[model samples]
Target: MTTQDLTNALNALSTGEHQNAIKGIKRGIERESLRIQSNGAISPTGHPKGVGSALTNGHITTDFSESLLEFITPVSESSTQTLKQLRDLQKFTLENMGDELLWPISMPCFINHQDDIVLAQFGSSNIGKMKTLYREGLKNRYGSMMQAIAGVHFNISFPESLWKSLHSLKQSNASLQDFISDGYLSLIRNFKRELWLISYMFGASPALCNSFLQGRKTDLPFKKLGKGTLYLEVGTALRLGNLGYTNSAQSSLRVMYNSLDEYVAGLKKAINTPSDIYSDIDDYTSEQPKQLNKNILQIENEFYSPIRPKRNANSGETPTDALLRAGIEYVEIRALDVNPFSEVGIDIEQIHFLDVFLTYCLLKDSPNMDWKEQARSTENLDAVVNQGREQGLMLNDNNTPRSLQSWGNQIFAQLTDVAKWMDKAYGVSYYSETIERMSMWVNDPSLTYSGRYVAKLKESGLDNGHFALELANKYKQSHIETDYSEFLKPWLEQQVEQSNEAQRNIENADAQSFTAFLDEYFHKN
Candidate 1:
C-alpha cells in the first residue's frame, strides 16, 4: 500500500466509532453471577513452586532433563488426535479442581520424531499417570497428594515444519474428513500466524538495542532490531511451562524465526523488484549492512536467554546447548496471561482486535522510529501491567502526557476500520464484535483482565492465594457444567492411583534411602 493509503487506513481505524458495535455483541456473551467472597489465604510471596532459588529471582527456569528429551522429539508435527487430547486434558484439569496449588503444574505431552521434523503432542489425561490420581475412580486414593502440588502448569511446542504441512493442506480442496483429521495442524498454524503478527509489532529490534530494557547494556548490541515479539516475565514463563507448553521457549523461538524470515524476505523483495501495479513504494537499497543482519543471535542469547534459562547449572545443562539443540531462532513472546475468566488463553474477540493492531504495526511506515519510542512503549507496558486504570498513571506519547484511555480509544478507532475490512474479506461477524470490544476496553479500562484482577482481590478481602482458589473453584464449576468432563474421568483416576502407589512405596522404604535408587531415578549419568 502507498504511504497515503496506509495513513488514511490508520486514521479511519483510530476514530473510535465501534463502541455501538460492541454493545450489540455483548448480548451474545454468556453471563454468570459474579460471586465475590473471600476466604482468608495468603499468596506465596517469593517465587512459584518446583523451581530453583537461583532461577527464581524473577526469570524463566526450565527442567533441563525435560528440555533435553523435548529437543530430540520433533514436537512440531503433532497430529489432530494429540491436539484434541490436549484440549480434553485441559478440560479435565479444570474439572475437580480446588486451589491453583492442587492443579498439575505442567501439561504433559509426548513428542515423536519424524525425519527432519518433530511432532510434539499432548496426551489425554487417561493415557499416562493422570488416569490414576485425579480420576473419579481413584480420587480417594490420591486427594491429599493433589492438594499439595496445585499451582503447576506446562505446555508443548511443535516444529515449523508442522505449519508448512498445514499450509500445504489448506491449498488443497480437502474433504471434511481430511480437514477433521488435520484440525490440530490448522490450529497450530493459526496460532503461529497470530504469534508472528504480534511478534513483528511488539518485539525489540536490533536498531534500538538501548531501548527495550530501558537502556540496559546488551551484550550483543546491534544497530537495528525488529519489533513485535513479546517477552515473557519470569513468573509467566514458569506458569506456562507448568501448564504444559513443554517446549515453550524453543517452540516460540522457532515460530518467531520462521515468521520473521518470511516477513523480512517479502519486504526486501517487494522493495527491490519493480512493481508496475504498486509503483509508489520507496527503495531500501541504501540500508546499511549493520542495519541488515541486526545481530539477532546476540540479542537472543545475551539478553533474552539469561533472563529465562532453559536449564539449571545443577542439572548440567548450559544455555548454549539448549539453544543449539532447540535451533533457537528469534525471541519468543511469553508475556501474555490467560484471563482466568475466559475459557481460552485469549478470547476470539480479543484475537480479532489484536489482528488489526498487529497489521497496523507492520503496514505503517516507521523507518525513522528510534530507541526513544521503544523506551516509551516499554514504560507504557509496565504501567498497564502494574497500575493500569489507577488514578494518575498516564502514558507519555512524543513528550505529551495522555490518559491511557485516550490513547487506547485512538487505537480502537484504527482497529474499527481494520475490522470492517476483515468482515468484508472473511465474512465473519466476529471482527465487528472485536472492534466493539476494543471500544469497550478503551471507554472503561477497568474491564481489562488486570483491572478486574485487582478489583477481585480487593472485593474478596482475600490474599492472592485465596483469589486463585476462588478462580479454581469457578473453573471447576464451569467444567462440570460442560460436556467435556467425561473425558477427564480416566486421567484423574490414573493420577490418584499413581499418587497412592508413590505413597505406598515411600512408606515401605527404609529411613535411609538407597543411594542407587536416587542416583538412577533423579540423576542422569
Candidate 2:
C-alpha cells in the first residue's frame, strides 16, 4: 500500500464511519520502575501490601527484581483513559511507599554490585514459583545488574469492527484471525525497519553513572561529568544498545515474522534446544531445580524484541501457546524508554503519535524481511541507539543509505493526512498536536529527549545519578501532592485483598508435585 492508497481508503469512509473506526482503537500501558532512595540508590524495600500482591494483582506487579515495580493498566478504548489509569496507579503506589521514589530513568545508575540486586520474590504456589524461577534463570544467564534496567511497554489492538472494515476493503478470503495476525506481523516487520525513528525521537538515557559500567569495556569515547558520570555527547538511548536487555545466545535464534507458524516453530525449537553454557551453570540433580531447564530459553518471554505480537494467555498457556491457540490479539511495543520529562513516564502526545504511526504501519506496504534485511535492521537500530543525534548520521533504508533526518521528514509528511483524519474524526486536536510538536524534533535534534537530558545534565552541574534522582523526587512529590480519584483508592484497596485471597486459594489448590507440574506445563501446549 502506498501513501495515496491510505489516503484514498480514509477518504472513502464517511466522517461518522471514520469516527467509529477511530473509537475502536484499544490501548494499555505497562510502566516499570526501580524503587530508589532519596539520595539515589536502589531501595531494598519489600513490595508494599497496600500496592497489592505481585502474584494475583491485575494492575501492579514486580518485573525482574523486588525493587522493580511494573504498573499495568487495563485495556481502554482511548489514550486518555489509559493514561488516567496509569496516573491513578502511580498515585496509589506513592501513597504506599514511605520515603522511596520511583527511578525516573530506564538505565539504573546507583547499584554498588550485582549481588545487591534482589531477584523478585513470589509466593510458594506452583505458578508463582515458576515465575521467580524464570527470573532466576535470567539472572544466571545474564548478570543480575543488567536485568535491573527499566522500560515502558505500550500495548495496542484494534477491535474486530476495524479489522472487518479493512478486510472488506481488501476483499480478502482468509479467516478473520489469520487476516488480523498477518496484518500484525506486517506491522511488526515495519516497526523493526523503522524503529530508529522512535529511538531518535523519544530516547532519553544518554548518560550513566560509572557504577553501571563497572568492569566493562567500551569502544566509543565518552566524556566525563562530576566524578562518576560518563556519556556519549550524541548517544540517544544507551539502554537500547549493547548494555540493555541483550543476550548473545538469543541473538542467533533468527525468529522471523513471515508467518505465525514460522514464528511459533522458531520459539519452540529454541525451548527444546539445549544450551551447553546454561548446562554448565548449574547441576539440577538436587531436589530444587537451578533453572527451569537446560534449554536456550526458559520460556518464550525470554526472547527480547523491540515489538511483540501478543495474546492474553489462558490459565496455563505460555506466550507462544497463547499466540498459537488464538493467533495475535495485540502488539506490544517494548522499545520506548521511561521519558523522565513527563511525570507519568509518558505523555498523551506520545501515545497519540504512536496510534498514528502504528495505523500508518498497518496501511503501508511491508515486504517480508530475509536474513540480510533483518541484519540491516539490527544495524540501523544499533546506530540510532549509540549516536542518533551525531552530525550527518545515516541509516540503512533497505540496502541504500539515507540521512536520518530526510527519512523522518518523508514519514512525517505522510503522517499529516493521518493526523488530519484523526482530528476530524475525533473533533479534537490530540493527534494533530503530536504531529506538529514531533515534526520539530525531526528538524531540530536539540529538541529530542536525549538532547534535552544531556543539556540539562551540563546546565545543572550534577552527575547523571544526581540529575535523575532530582527528577525522581520532583515527580514523587508531584504525585504525592496531586489528589487521587476517590474511586481508585477504594478500588485498589479491594484489589489488594482480592489478590491476597487469590494467592491463598492457589496455594491451597496445588495438588501435583512441582516436578510433575513442570512436566505438564512443558508438554501441555
The candidate maximizing lDDT is: 2
- What TM-score against the true fold does each predicted structure earn? 0.41, 0.97
**Clash count list over all predictions:** 78, 0
**Which stretches of candidate 2 lie above 4 Å from their native place?**
13-20, 283-285
**What is the Cα-based lDDT of residue 160 in candidate 2?**
85
Model 2, 1-525: lDDT tens digits are: 567877776775434544456557889999999988777899888887788789999899999899999999998886777777888898898889888899999999689998788888889988888888888888888888889999999999977877877787779999999999999999999888899999999999889888987779988668999989989899899888888878889888979999999999998899889997798755233476668888998888898889999999987778888998999999999999999898889988789899989987876778997878888988998998888998779999878889999889989988888888777766778788789889989878899999999999999999999999889888988888887653368878899899999999999999987777788887764
Model 1 lDDT per residue over 20-77, tens place? 2212110011111111112312122222222222121111111111121110001222
Roughly what TM-score does model 2 have, to 2 decimal places?
0.97
Whole-model alpha-carbon lDDT for candidate 2: 0.86
lDDT (CA) for every model shown?
Answer: 0.32, 0.86
